[model samples]
Target: MKQHIRLLKTYLKPQRKRVVLLVLLLFGSIALDLLAPRQLSLFIDGAEAGASLDALVTVAVVFIVLTIAKQLVVAVAGYFSEDVGWRATNALRADLADHCLNLDISFHKDHTPGELMERVDGDVGVLSDFMSLFVFSVLGRALLAVGILGLVFSTDYRIGLLLLAYSLFVVLVLRRLQSVGVPHFNALRRTKADLSGFLEERLTSTEDIRANGARPYVMHRLSEHVENLVRRTRASMISARVFSSVLEISLAAATGGVFALGAWLLPGGSISLGEIFLIYYYTQLLSLSLIVITHHLDTLQKATGAIQRISELYHTTPQVRDGEGGSLPDGALDVTFDAVSFGYGEASRTLDEVSFALPAGETVGLLGRTGSGKTTLTRLLCRAYDVDAGAVRLADVDVRDLRLADLRDRIGVVTQDVQLFHASLRDNVTLFDATIDDGHIERAFAELGLSDWYASQPDGLDTVMVNGGETLSAGEAQLLALTRVMLRDPDIIVLDEASSRLDPGTERLIARATERLLKGRTGIVVAHRLATVRKVDHIVVLDDGEVCEAGPRERLEADPASRFSALIAGGTA
Candidate 1:
């Protein structure tokens, strides 16, 4: 509870004036509520005393006005509470998203998108509702309870003692029930996240599932997951109901005592008719508070469970963090892998003491059999993953000692897989950065010798594209990726089988663009098809994660017995 309050303060602190206004409105509503009952007591007492009709009417009118004012204040408080809760939770969600984005590739690989979505969206939403309820549903009603008890004690000590015991018992019992309920609800939330992950995976692969005739299998598995969720949800509800049942039973017992005591004391005239009504009505008010608490108790437990999960996520420190903020030297940086060794989390080494170098402003082709660590080398160059041992140096500066942003800024990578968004062509080309001028985009296309292809678009750069480039061919998507790299004009660039998916005509266009892109830049061109190998100054061949051959491309190709010469003859690596 202390942690919950602390978190509320943290998020609510920025909107201090709104929160203050909300608190004032809540207190005003509670005061009106408390005052209304007092006015009712006065009206009854005045009527019983044979007072003038006008005096009784005035008291009744006052009670009506207080009731109306309470509702109005309550409505205003609701608005402010919701407004504050929404802003705070949205800020929390944004922070969580930014944190997740900074996490390394390994963290993303371990978590499903759907699971993350549930954490960011579902959990935060629960916290948002609970935040609002904590103010009015819990604290405001608590004050009302205290006020009711205080008035009762002033009138009669015995009744106040009875109701105080009732209140204390309810609190203690509900708290115990909450401790037992949290685990079940936590399990329920995890199951929901699992279901969401399963659904997201299946939905994304709908094409494969339908084409492979695996629909029945998918449906059967989905049914099993749905059934598990249903069972957990039922179990969770049953656990929650225990709190409600306890409160109802306790309320019935307390209400019986208040009625019995009121009747016994009424006959002796020890308590006036008006005073007796006040006690009964205030007892009813106490029961209402108990009901409100009972209803929100489940919410409290859900929020408690959400906070635990959110805390765990918040505390997760990323494996990849910024280095000592070292700066890189300007323009066409040389690349080096010095005795580098790496593996993916307990797997066998993918790159074992691999050593290589390329002079500044020179292009090299990386040749390898499948799983020979070609892609891994490029990833290390960009510091997507740090080396397990040894250093990846650019311009002779150790990459581990440089800030990731600074290192990556100078090295641009265009992979074979191009991901496009559902947005305008300019947005897609600029990756949603609107600051880039159209003139630069035109210059990039012209440099790539893609002006003719660019002009063929119905709306040129303003054309909206479908998500994942479904509206564009594979070759066109790759071209867009090249355009992105061209725009960046980094000191170092990597191309991963860039021309693999194109027709001969598109291949020529990409080859021309590839030549333009690699000009005046250090390049690591990965070629499985050997189409781009002829353009490189040097070649490095990896077999089983060790460099077996590396030399000047012209020298190696001239040797009939050399691996590069054989790979060129075979037309593949």
Candidate 2:
């Protein structure tokens, strides 16, 4: 509860002025609404007393005008309320997105994109309802109920006391019911998130599912998730409806009791007809207001569940912290791994005591079999994960001692799996960096021998890549990835099986581009094919997380005992 209040206060602080104006408008509407009943009572009493027709017409017009004004005020108040709610929730959505982006790769590996979307968007959307309805439905109705009670009490003490006591009883009972329903709502949210994640995964893998003939199994799994979600949702709804029914029945009984008491008092002349009518009107008003409040209470319970989940996300601390260290030096930077050892969680070390170095302006080929730590070595250089022991360095300075953005900006990586968004070709190459101009893009394409490919597109850079780059072939995607790396112009480059997807024709083009791209720059090529690394200055071969061979490529290839030579001879490179 404290956390919920704190979050509300933090988000509401920026919209304080709008909130204040909304409150004033609410009061105006409620005050005007309450006046109608009073004027109706006046007209009733006047008619009974044989008052002037003109005076009665004046009261009738005033009553109609007040009702219309109250509606207009309510409409305006609702507008302000929605405005504030959207702004606050949108701000929260942006914050969640930024926080998720800053989290480490391990965090992303543990959570799917769909689950994160639910957390960042779906949960915040629930809070939007809570904010918009909170003012009018919750607070306004409560205030209106109290005002009705006060007006009734001024007319007759006995009836006022009964209604007040009934309102209190209803509120207490509903509060207890909400406490019981909250856990169910929380469970429902979890199941819904799971369902969303499953759907997203299945949708993205539709092709594989069909190709592997696993559609039936996938459908069965999806049905199980849907069943669980339905069960949880039904349970939450049942609890809410049960409590709401109780409130409705209690208010109905209270209304009957009020009317019965007013009848007995009216006959005895203990209260005037006008006074009895006023008391009955206020009683109905109070009952309706309480009903609205109860409904809002149910929504509040759902929002409470959302708030708890969102708060948990906010509390998740990234395992990898950003460094506040200085920037890297300009020009080609040497890459070094000093006896580094690291693993994913409790798993055995992926890279165990790995030590290697590539001098400034030198290119090295990292040769290894599957699961032999070649890719892990490149990941360490990029600071995807901190070393379990020892340090990774650029230009003799520990990578950990450099700001995360600065370190990543100095090292460019191009992996086999090229990720292109559904955006314009220019946006894909520049990654939406507005600072990169057309000249840089043109030069990158020309230097990579993609001038003909660029010219083939009628729209040129403005051409939109759709379906995650399905518009381009595998080789074309690789070329685009290379162009992205070239445009960044980083000091050090890491190519992890980047050329494995290209055909012979494209491979030759990329090889020339790679050689030209490595000029005066440090590079590490994690090669699966020997031909790709034949021209590299040196080679480092890893076996089971340990480097077994390291030296000039010519020397390593000449040595019969060298693992690099054995792998080459065995045609496994």
Candidate 3:
């Protein structure tokens, strides 16, 4: 409850002006609505006393005008309230996106993209509607209820007290019932995210599922998720319905009781007919307000659940902290890993006390079997994950002691699985960095042997890549990634099997590009093929997270007993 209130304050603080305006409008609307009941009573009593036609007509017009004005105020207030709600919710959405992006890769590995989307977007959408209702419907109706009760007491204190007692009773019952619904709503939210994640994962792998003939299995899992969501949703709905029904029944009984009391008192001259009618009218108005309040309460409960989930996300601390560190030294930076050790969570170390160094403007080849920590080593170099022990350094300064932006800005990474957005070729090549000029891009493409591919495009740099670069071949995507890296011109480059996905012809083109890219930059190549690393100055071989061989490639190749020689002989390099 405290967390929800804190979350509300944090998001709503920026919209105080709108909130105040909405409240003023609520007061005006409620005043107009309450005045209509009095006008009706005055009309009825004046008619009973044979009042003038002109006076009656005037009251009728005033009542109609009041009704229209009340609705207009409500409409204006609702619009502003909705505007404020969306602005605050969008702020929260942006914060969530930024937070998720800053979290460590391990955190991302534990969660699916669809689940995070549901939490960041879907949950906030629920809060938006609830916020609007809270500002307009809940507050406005609550004030109306209080105003009616006060007016009823001015007419007849005894009946007003009785109605107040019944209102409290109904509120207590509904509050208790709402407590039962909150947990169910929370569960329902989780189930919905699970369903979203399941569907997203399945849709993304549609080809694999179809080719493997696993449609039945996928459908069964989806059905199970749907069934779970339905059950929880039904439970929450049933609880809310019960609360609404009880409030309706109780309010109806109270109205009947008031009517009976008024009838009995009228004969004794304890109350006038107008007063009886006033009390009854106010009772009905109060009933409507109570119904609105009850409905808003249900919405509030669901929003509370969403707020708790969102707060949980906000409270998640990133394992990788951005240290207040200095910038890197200028020029090509030598890379060094001094007895580095790391792991994912409680798992065994992926890089166990590994140590190696490459001088500035030198190239090193990393040869390792699967799960031998080649990629992990590069990740550590980039500070994607801090070392569990020892240090990774650039130019003798620990990577952790360099500002994250500065460290990453000077290093470039190209992986086998390239990511291309659905955007224009210029945007894809620059990755939306407006500072990269078209001339630089054109030169990079030509230098990297991608000019022929570029010429084949009818729209040149304006051509749009669709469906995650489906229009381009795998090798083309890899080349595009390399072009982006070359444009950035980082001092250190990590090529993690960047040419592994290309055919022989494309591989030759990429190899020529790679050689040009590595000319003046320090390079670490995670080699999947021995031929790709033949000209590398140094070689490091890993077996079970330990460095088994480290030397010049020619020397390792010359020694028959060396791990690199054995790998080549076994055709495993």
Clashing pairs in 1: none
Q: Score residue 414 of candidate 2 by CA lDDT.
A: 85
Clashes of each: 0, 0, 0
TM-score of 3: 0.95
Off by over 4 Å in 2: 468-470
Weakest ten-residue segment in model 3 by summed lDDT: 465-474
Q: What is the TM-score (0 to 1) of candidate 2?
A: 0.95
Q: Model 2: per-residue lDDT, tens digit, 103-190?
A: 8889989898889998999999998998899888888888998888888888888998889899889879877998999999999988
Summarize candidate 1's per-residue lDDT along 1-573 as a digit string, tens digits.
565567667788999999889989988987887789888788888888999999988999988898999889988899898899899999989999998888888888999989999998999999989887888888888888998999899988888899999999988998899999999999999999989999999998888999999999999999998999999899889988988998899999999998888888888877888888888999998899879978888788899999888877866888877889777778898899999999996869999999989999998999998899999999888878989998999888899889888888898888888888888779888998888999999999999999999998899888988854357888888889999989887989899888767799888888998889989999999978887778899999998878989989999999999999998888888
| Candidate 2: Cα lDDT at 273 | 84
Candidate 2: pairs in clash: none
